[model samples]
Target: MTAIRLFGLAALLSLSSMASATSFVGTTDMIGRALISTTDGISDLSSSLKDDKIVLAARDDAASFVASQGEIRGARLHAALQHIRTQAPQLNASDLQLAEAILAL
Candidate 1:
Protein backbone atom coordinates (compact mmCIF):
# COMPACT_ATOMS: atom_id res chain seq x y z
CA MET A 1 0.00 0.00 0.00
CA THR A 2 2.80 2.41 0.91
CA ALA A 3 4.65 1.56 -2.34
CA ILE A 4 1.52 2.25 -4.34
CA ARG A 5 1.10 5.64 -2.66
CA LEU A 6 4.71 6.54 -3.43
CA PHE A 7 4.25 5.60 -7.08
CA GLY A 8 1.17 7.77 -7.32
CA LEU A 9 2.98 10.67 -5.70
CA ALA A 10 5.84 10.34 -8.15
CA ALA A 11 3.44 10.30 -11.06
CA LEU A 12 1.71 13.40 -9.75
CA LEU A 13 5.03 15.20 -9.43
CA SER A 14 6.01 14.27 -12.97
CA LEU A 15 2.74 15.56 -14.36
CA SER A 16 3.03 18.77 -12.42
CA SER A 17 6.52 19.31 -13.76
CA MET A 18 5.37 18.72 -17.31
CA ALA A 19 2.50 21.16 -16.98
CA SER A 20 4.80 23.84 -15.57
CA ALA A 21 7.28 23.32 -18.36
CA THR A 22 4.60 23.46 -21.05
CA SER A 23 3.20 26.69 -19.65
CA PHE A 24 6.64 28.29 -19.68
CA VAL A 25 7.31 27.14 -23.22
CA GLY A 26 3.95 28.45 -24.42
CA THR A 27 4.58 31.84 -22.86
CA THR A 28 7.99 32.10 -24.47
CA ASP A 29 6.59 31.10 -27.85
CA MET A 30 3.98 33.85 -27.64
CA ILE A 31 6.54 36.52 -26.80
CA GLY A 32 8.93 35.38 -29.48
CA ARG A 33 6.15 35.45 -32.05
CA ALA A 34 5.20 38.97 -31.06
CA LEU A 35 8.68 40.39 -31.53
CA ILE A 36 9.26 38.66 -34.82
CA SER A 37 5.98 39.97 -36.19
CA THR A 38 7.16 43.54 -35.93
CA THR A 39 9.34 44.39 -38.92
CA ASP A 40 11.11 47.39 -37.45
CA GLY A 41 11.43 45.65 -34.13
CA ILE A 42 12.94 42.58 -35.77
CA SER A 43 15.54 44.74 -37.47
CA ASP A 44 16.39 46.38 -34.18
CA LEU A 45 16.58 43.03 -32.50
CA SER A 46 18.90 41.73 -35.17
CA SER A 47 21.22 44.65 -34.61
CA SER A 48 21.13 44.13 -30.86
CA LEU A 49 21.92 40.46 -31.29
CA LYS A 50 24.95 41.06 -33.49
CA ASP A 51 27.44 41.16 -30.61
CA ASP A 52 25.54 38.55 -28.65
CA LYS A 53 26.88 34.99 -28.69
CA ILE A 54 23.57 33.27 -29.36
CA VAL A 55 22.99 34.77 -32.79
CA LEU A 56 20.67 32.00 -33.91
CA ALA A 57 18.03 33.11 -31.46
CA ALA A 58 16.37 35.09 -34.24
CA ARG A 59 15.49 31.88 -36.07
CA ASP A 60 12.93 30.88 -33.47
CA ASP A 61 11.34 34.29 -33.67
CA ALA A 62 11.35 34.01 -37.45
CA ALA A 63 9.71 30.62 -37.17
CA SER A 64 7.04 32.15 -34.97
CA PHE A 65 6.42 34.75 -37.63
CA VAL A 66 6.09 32.08 -40.28
CA ALA A 67 3.66 30.16 -38.11
CA SER A 68 1.42 33.19 -37.60
CA GLN A 69 1.50 34.26 -41.23
CA GLY A 70 0.05 30.90 -42.34
CA GLU A 71 -1.12 27.78 -40.52
CA ILE A 72 0.71 25.18 -42.61
CA ARG A 73 3.79 27.37 -42.77
CA GLY A 74 3.76 27.81 -39.04
CA ALA A 75 3.52 24.05 -38.47
CA ARG A 76 6.54 23.47 -40.64
CA LEU A 77 8.48 26.24 -38.91
CA HIS A 78 7.59 24.79 -35.51
CA ALA A 79 8.84 21.38 -36.61
CA ALA A 80 12.06 22.92 -37.83
CA LEU A 81 12.67 24.65 -34.52
CA GLN A 82 12.04 21.40 -32.63
CA HIS A 83 14.34 19.49 -34.93
CA ILE A 84 17.18 22.01 -34.62
CA ARG A 85 16.94 22.18 -30.86
CA THR A 86 16.80 18.43 -30.36
CA GLN A 87 19.57 17.65 -32.82
CA ALA A 88 22.04 20.23 -31.53
CA PRO A 89 22.08 20.58 -27.78
CA GLN A 90 25.29 22.58 -27.64
CA LEU A 91 24.27 24.99 -30.34
CA ASN A 92 20.85 25.31 -28.77
CA ALA A 93 22.29 26.48 -25.46
CA SER A 94 23.81 29.57 -27.05
CA ASP A 95 20.57 30.20 -28.88
CA LEU A 96 18.61 29.82 -25.67
CA GLN A 97 20.89 32.31 -23.94
CA LEU A 98 20.43 34.77 -26.78
CA ALA A 99 16.69 34.29 -26.49
CA GLU A 100 16.84 34.99 -22.78
CA ALA A 101 18.71 38.21 -23.49
CA ILE A 102 16.18 39.21 -26.11
CA LEU A 103 13.37 38.56 -23.67
CA ALA A 104 15.07 40.82 -21.17
CA LEU A 105 15.12 43.54 -23.82
Candidate 2:
Protein backbone atom coordinates (compact mmCIF):
# COMPACT_ATOMS: atom_id res chain seq x y z
CA MET A 1 0.00 0.00 0.00
CA THR A 2 2.82 2.44 0.83
CA ALA A 3 4.57 1.63 -2.44
CA ILE A 4 1.42 2.34 -4.33
CA ARG A 5 1.02 5.68 -2.57
CA LEU A 6 4.61 6.60 -3.36
CA PHE A 7 4.11 5.73 -7.01
CA GLY A 8 1.08 7.94 -7.17
CA LEU A 9 2.93 10.79 -5.52
CA ALA A 10 5.79 10.50 -7.95
CA ALA A 11 3.45 10.54 -10.90
CA LEU A 12 1.65 13.55 -9.55
CA LEU A 13 4.88 15.40 -9.00
CA SER A 14 6.10 14.66 -12.50
CA LEU A 15 2.81 15.73 -14.01
CA SER A 16 2.83 19.01 -12.12
CA SER A 17 6.34 19.84 -13.30
CA MET A 18 5.46 19.01 -16.89
CA ALA A 19 2.43 21.23 -16.73
CA SER A 20 4.47 24.09 -15.32
CA ALA A 21 7.06 23.76 -18.08
CA THR A 22 4.34 23.66 -20.71
CA SER A 23 2.79 26.84 -19.34
CA PHE A 24 6.17 28.56 -19.43
CA VAL A 25 6.63 27.72 -23.09
CA GLY A 26 3.08 28.78 -23.82
CA THR A 27 3.70 32.16 -22.20
CA THR A 28 6.71 32.76 -24.41
CA ASP A 29 4.84 31.77 -27.57
CA MET A 30 1.86 33.88 -26.60
CA ILE A 31 4.00 36.95 -25.98
CA GLY A 32 5.84 36.48 -29.26
CA ARG A 33 2.67 36.16 -31.28
CA ALA A 34 1.04 39.15 -29.62
CA LEU A 35 4.09 41.35 -30.26
CA ILE A 36 4.24 40.25 -33.87
CA SER A 37 0.58 40.95 -34.46
CA THR A 38 0.76 44.39 -32.88
CA THR A 39 3.87 45.61 -34.72
CA ASP A 40 4.19 46.58 -38.36
CA GLY A 41 6.61 44.02 -39.89
CA ILE A 42 9.05 46.59 -41.25
CA SER A 43 11.95 45.85 -38.89
CA ASP A 44 13.92 42.63 -38.93
CA LEU A 45 15.18 40.57 -36.05
CA SER A 46 18.74 39.50 -35.55
CA SER A 47 20.25 38.15 -38.75
CA SER A 48 21.63 35.22 -36.82
CA LEU A 49 22.71 34.76 -33.21
CA LYS A 50 26.23 33.34 -33.42
CA ASP A 51 27.54 34.96 -30.28
CA ASP A 52 26.09 33.56 -27.07
CA LYS A 53 27.86 36.33 -25.18
CA ILE A 54 25.74 39.07 -26.72
CA VAL A 55 22.53 37.24 -25.97
CA LEU A 56 23.73 36.40 -22.48
CA ALA A 57 24.29 40.07 -21.80
CA ALA A 58 20.58 40.78 -21.90
CA ARG A 59 19.21 37.51 -20.58
CA ASP A 60 17.81 39.04 -17.37
CA ASP A 61 15.76 41.73 -19.10
CA ALA A 62 14.59 39.23 -21.66
CA ALA A 63 13.32 36.95 -18.97
CA SER A 64 11.59 39.85 -17.24
CA PHE A 65 9.95 40.90 -20.50
CA VAL A 66 8.66 37.41 -21.05
CA ALA A 67 7.50 37.11 -17.45
CA SER A 68 5.62 40.39 -17.69
CA GLN A 69 4.05 39.27 -20.94
CA GLY A 70 6.05 42.16 -22.44
CA GLU A 71 4.80 44.78 -20.00
CA ILE A 72 8.35 45.32 -18.79
CA ARG A 73 10.70 46.70 -21.41
CA GLY A 74 14.25 46.95 -20.22
CA ALA A 75 16.78 49.54 -21.29
CA ARG A 76 19.35 46.77 -21.53
CA LEU A 77 17.13 44.99 -24.02
CA HIS A 78 17.04 48.01 -26.33
CA ALA A 79 20.79 48.33 -26.05
CA ALA A 80 21.27 44.68 -26.85
CA LEU A 81 18.84 44.83 -29.76
CA GLN A 82 20.70 47.77 -31.29
CA HIS A 83 23.93 45.91 -30.78
CA ILE A 84 22.47 42.89 -32.53
CA ARG A 85 21.22 45.00 -35.41
CA THR A 86 24.57 46.66 -35.90
CA GLN A 87 26.26 43.26 -35.90
CA ALA A 88 23.76 41.77 -38.36
CA PRO A 89 21.40 43.90 -40.42
CA GLN A 90 19.91 42.14 -43.44
CA LEU A 91 17.03 40.01 -42.24
CA ASN A 92 13.36 40.98 -42.00
CA ALA A 93 11.28 40.97 -38.82
CA SER A 94 9.67 43.43 -36.44
CA ASP A 95 11.26 44.99 -33.38
CA LEU A 96 8.89 43.03 -31.20
CA GLN A 97 9.93 39.81 -32.84
CA LEU A 98 13.55 40.77 -32.40
CA ALA A 99 12.82 41.43 -28.73
CA GLU A 100 11.25 38.01 -28.48
CA ALA A 101 14.24 36.51 -30.26
CA ILE A 102 16.54 38.20 -27.77
CA LEU A 103 14.48 36.60 -24.99
CA ALA A 104 14.81 33.24 -26.65
CA LEU A 105 18.53 33.84 -26.85
Candidate 3:
Protein backbone atom coordinates (compact mmCIF):
# COMPACT_ATOMS: atom_id res chain seq x y z
CA MET A 1 0.00 0.00 0.00
CA THR A 2 2.79 2.43 0.93
CA ALA A 3 4.63 1.61 -2.32
CA ILE A 4 1.46 2.21 -4.33
CA ARG A 5 0.95 5.54 -2.64
CA LEU A 6 4.54 6.56 -3.34
CA PHE A 7 4.15 5.63 -6.99
CA GLY A 8 0.92 7.61 -7.27
CA LEU A 9 2.53 10.62 -5.65
CA ALA A 10 5.44 10.43 -8.05
CA ALA A 11 3.08 10.18 -10.99
CA LEU A 12 1.14 13.21 -9.81
CA LEU A 13 4.34 15.22 -9.45
CA SER A 14 5.48 14.22 -12.91
CA LEU A 15 2.17 15.18 -14.43
CA SER A 16 2.27 18.54 -12.70
CA SER A 17 5.75 19.22 -13.98
CA MET A 18 4.68 18.32 -17.51
CA ALA A 19 1.76 20.69 -17.25
CA SER A 20 4.04 23.49 -16.12
CA ALA A 21 6.46 22.85 -18.97
CA THR A 22 3.61 22.83 -21.50
CA SER A 23 2.31 26.13 -20.19
CA PHE A 24 5.75 27.70 -20.49
CA VAL A 25 6.13 26.49 -24.04
CA GLY A 26 2.67 27.74 -24.92
CA THR A 27 3.48 31.18 -23.55
CA THR A 28 6.75 31.30 -25.46
CA ASP A 29 5.06 30.24 -28.68
CA MET A 30 2.35 32.85 -28.15
CA ILE A 31 4.99 35.56 -27.86
CA GLY A 32 6.71 34.37 -31.01
CA ARG A 33 3.42 34.24 -32.90
CA ALA A 34 2.50 37.71 -31.70
CA LEU A 35 5.78 39.03 -33.05
CA ILE A 36 5.15 37.35 -36.39
CA SER A 37 1.60 38.71 -36.67
CA THR A 38 2.74 42.19 -35.76
CA THR A 39 5.42 42.08 -38.42
CA ASP A 40 3.17 40.57 -41.07
CA GLY A 41 0.42 43.14 -40.42
CA ILE A 42 -2.33 40.56 -40.25
CA SER A 43 -4.42 39.78 -37.22
CA ASP A 44 -5.59 36.50 -38.70
CA LEU A 45 -2.76 35.10 -40.76
CA SER A 46 -3.88 31.52 -40.19
CA SER A 47 -5.36 31.28 -43.65
CA SER A 48 -2.15 32.51 -45.16
CA LEU A 49 0.00 30.35 -42.95
CA LYS A 50 -2.25 27.31 -43.48
CA ASP A 51 -2.28 26.67 -39.76
CA ASP A 52 -5.48 28.03 -38.32
CA LYS A 53 -4.89 27.06 -34.72
CA ILE A 54 -1.36 28.47 -34.43
CA VAL A 55 -2.11 31.66 -36.32
CA LEU A 56 -5.26 32.19 -34.30
CA ALA A 57 -3.23 31.83 -31.15
CA ALA A 58 -0.84 34.47 -32.45
CA ARG A 59 -3.73 36.77 -33.30
CA ASP A 60 -5.12 36.33 -29.82
CA ASP A 61 -1.82 37.35 -28.27
CA ALA A 62 -1.57 40.43 -30.49
CA ALA A 63 -5.19 41.30 -29.83
CA SER A 64 -4.62 41.05 -26.10
CA PHE A 65 -1.94 43.73 -26.36
CA VAL A 66 -4.10 45.98 -28.51
CA ALA A 67 -6.97 45.59 -26.10
CA SER A 68 -4.88 46.50 -23.09
CA GLN A 69 -2.63 49.19 -24.56
CA GLY A 70 -4.56 50.59 -27.49
CA GLU A 71 -3.29 50.25 -31.03
CA ILE A 72 0.35 49.35 -31.47
CA ARG A 73 1.99 51.62 -34.01
CA GLY A 74 5.14 53.67 -34.64
CA ALA A 75 7.29 54.04 -31.54
CA ARG A 76 4.93 52.04 -29.40
CA LEU A 77 5.32 48.99 -31.58
CA HIS A 78 9.07 49.41 -31.63
CA ALA A 79 9.18 49.71 -27.86
CA ALA A 80 7.04 46.63 -27.43
CA LEU A 81 9.23 44.62 -29.78
CA GLN A 82 12.32 45.79 -27.97
CA HIS A 83 10.86 44.75 -24.66
CA ILE A 84 9.95 41.34 -26.06
CA ARG A 85 13.45 40.89 -27.43
CA THR A 86 14.95 41.79 -24.08
CA GLN A 87 12.68 39.30 -22.38
CA ALA A 88 13.34 36.52 -24.92
CA PRO A 89 16.60 37.01 -26.72
CA GLN A 90 16.20 33.58 -28.28
CA LEU A 91 13.59 35.09 -30.56
CA ASN A 92 16.20 37.15 -32.43
CA ALA A 93 15.05 36.04 -35.87
CA SER A 94 11.52 37.19 -35.18
CA ASP A 95 12.89 40.45 -33.81
CA LEU A 96 14.78 41.09 -37.07
CA GLN A 97 11.63 40.53 -39.08
CA LEU A 98 9.70 42.82 -36.75
CA ALA A 99 12.37 45.49 -37.14
CA GLU A 100 12.06 45.33 -40.92
CA ALA A 101 8.31 45.55 -40.71
CA ILE A 102 8.54 48.52 -38.37
CA LEU A 103 10.84 50.30 -40.83
CA ALA A 104 8.39 49.69 -43.64
CA LEU A 105 5.63 51.18 -41.54
Candidate 4:
Protein backbone atom coordinates (compact mmCIF):
# COMPACT_ATOMS: atom_id res chain seq x y z
CA MET A 1 0.00 0.00 0.00
CA THR A 2 2.81 2.43 0.86
CA ALA A 3 4.55 1.72 -2.44
CA ILE A 4 1.34 2.39 -4.36
CA ARG A 5 0.83 5.65 -2.50
CA LEU A 6 4.37 6.74 -3.22
CA PHE A 7 3.93 5.95 -6.89
CA GLY A 8 0.77 8.02 -7.08
CA LEU A 9 2.45 10.94 -5.36
CA ALA A 10 5.38 10.80 -7.72
CA ALA A 11 3.07 10.78 -10.72
CA LEU A 12 1.15 13.80 -9.42
CA LEU A 13 4.35 15.74 -8.78
CA SER A 14 5.66 15.01 -12.26
CA LEU A 15 2.36 16.03 -13.83
CA SER A 16 2.26 19.31 -11.90
CA SER A 17 5.79 20.20 -12.92
CA MET A 18 4.93 19.50 -16.54
CA ALA A 19 1.87 21.71 -16.29
CA SER A 20 3.82 24.64 -14.86
CA ALA A 21 6.48 24.31 -17.55
CA THR A 22 3.89 24.41 -20.33
CA SER A 23 2.25 27.47 -18.79
CA PHE A 24 5.53 29.41 -19.21
CA VAL A 25 5.84 28.11 -22.75
CA GLY A 26 2.37 29.36 -23.52
CA THR A 27 3.36 32.75 -22.14
CA THR A 28 6.43 32.74 -24.34
CA ASP A 29 4.31 32.02 -27.39
CA MET A 30 1.95 34.85 -26.55
CA ILE A 31 4.81 37.30 -26.06
CA GLY A 32 6.46 36.25 -29.29
CA ARG A 33 3.25 36.67 -31.21
CA ALA A 34 2.71 40.10 -29.73
CA LEU A 35 6.21 41.17 -30.66
CA ILE A 36 5.80 39.97 -34.23
CA SER A 37 2.47 41.69 -34.61
CA THR A 38 3.39 44.98 -33.03
CA THR A 39 6.75 45.62 -34.68
CA ASP A 40 6.47 47.96 -37.69
CA GLY A 41 8.50 50.47 -39.63
CA ILE A 42 10.41 52.90 -37.40
CA SER A 43 9.11 51.33 -34.19
CA ASP A 44 11.02 49.51 -31.46
CA LEU A 45 10.32 46.02 -30.08
CA SER A 46 10.99 47.26 -26.56
CA SER A 47 7.96 49.55 -26.70
CA SER A 48 5.66 46.60 -27.24
CA LEU A 49 7.50 44.30 -24.84
CA LYS A 50 7.37 46.70 -21.92
CA ASP A 51 3.64 46.33 -21.30
CA ASP A 52 3.52 42.59 -20.64
CA LYS A 53 4.81 40.47 -17.79
CA ILE A 54 5.70 37.48 -19.92
CA VAL A 55 7.55 39.58 -22.45
CA LEU A 56 9.35 41.30 -19.60
CA ALA A 57 10.50 37.92 -18.38
CA ALA A 58 11.68 36.99 -21.85
CA ARG A 59 13.45 40.35 -22.18
CA ASP A 60 15.23 39.72 -18.91
CA ASP A 61 16.35 36.35 -20.19
CA ALA A 62 17.61 37.94 -23.38
CA ALA A 63 19.34 40.70 -21.41
CA SER A 64 21.13 38.08 -19.33
CA PHE A 65 22.27 36.40 -22.52
CA VAL A 66 23.48 39.71 -23.91
CA ALA A 67 25.27 40.67 -20.69
CA SER A 68 27.19 37.41 -20.61
CA GLN A 69 28.21 37.72 -24.26
CA GLY A 70 28.66 41.52 -24.43
CA GLU A 71 26.51 43.66 -26.78
CA ILE A 72 23.51 42.37 -28.73
CA ARG A 73 23.54 43.48 -32.33
CA GLY A 74 23.42 41.73 -35.68
CA ALA A 75 25.26 38.43 -35.26
CA ARG A 76 25.20 38.60 -31.48
CA LEU A 77 21.42 38.76 -31.40
CA HIS A 78 21.29 35.83 -33.79
CA ALA A 79 23.57 33.88 -31.50
CA ALA A 80 21.35 34.64 -28.53
CA LEU A 81 18.33 33.43 -30.45
CA GLN A 82 20.10 30.24 -31.34
CA HIS A 83 21.07 29.71 -27.74
CA ILE A 84 17.46 30.20 -26.67
CA ARG A 85 16.35 27.71 -29.31
CA THR A 86 18.64 25.04 -27.90
CA GLN A 87 17.96 25.84 -24.25
CA ALA A 88 14.18 26.01 -24.63
CA PRO A 89 13.27 24.43 -27.92
CA GLN A 90 9.50 24.67 -27.62
CA LEU A 91 9.48 28.35 -26.68
CA ASN A 92 12.13 29.39 -29.18
CA ALA A 93 10.42 27.49 -31.99
CA SER A 94 7.28 29.51 -31.43
CA ASP A 95 9.24 32.77 -31.22
CA LEU A 96 11.05 32.02 -34.46
CA GLN A 97 7.86 31.21 -36.28
CA LEU A 98 6.31 34.49 -35.19
CA ALA A 99 9.48 36.42 -36.00
CA GLU A 100 9.29 35.09 -39.55
CA ALA A 101 5.92 36.76 -39.94
CA ILE A 102 7.31 40.27 -39.43
CA LEU A 103 9.12 42.37 -42.00
CA ALA A 104 12.69 43.42 -41.26
CA LEU A 105 11.87 47.04 -41.87
Question: Could you list the CA RMSD of all candidates, in the order they appear?
Answer: 13.6, 12.4, 14.5, 14.7
Expressed as tens digits, the lDDT of each residue in 1-103 for candidate 4 is 6999999999999999999999999999999977665444113443433353443334444554445553433443455455444544434234333233222
- Give RMSD (Å) of candidate 4 vs. truth: 14.7
The model with the greatest TM-score is 2
| lDDT per residue as tens, model 2, 68-95 | 7778878887687777667666545555
Residue-wise lDDT of candidate 3 within 2-105, one digit each (tens)?
99999999999999999999999999999998777564452222123333332333443454444555344444455546554554454434533433322332
Query: Between the candidate structures 2 and 4, which one is better when assessed by TM-score?
Result: 2
lDDT of 1 by residue, 47-101 (tens): 6555543435445564445445433233433444455455443342333333443
**Pairwise lDDT winner, candidates 1 and 2:** 2
Local lDDT at 85 for model 2: 67
Task: Highest lDDT: give the candidate number.
Answer: 2
After superposing all C-alphas onto the true structure, candidate 2 shows an RMSD in angstroms of 12.4
For candidate 3, the per-residue lDDT at 24 reads 100
Model 4 lDDT, residue 69, Cα: 56
Better of 3 and 4 by TM-score: 3
Query: By descending lDDT, how would the candidates be arranged?
Result: 2, 1, 3, 4
Per model, how many backbone clashes are there? Answer: 1, 2, 0, 0
Cα deviation at 46, candidate 4, in Å, is 16
| Residue 23 displacement (Å), model 2 | 36
Clashes of 3: 0
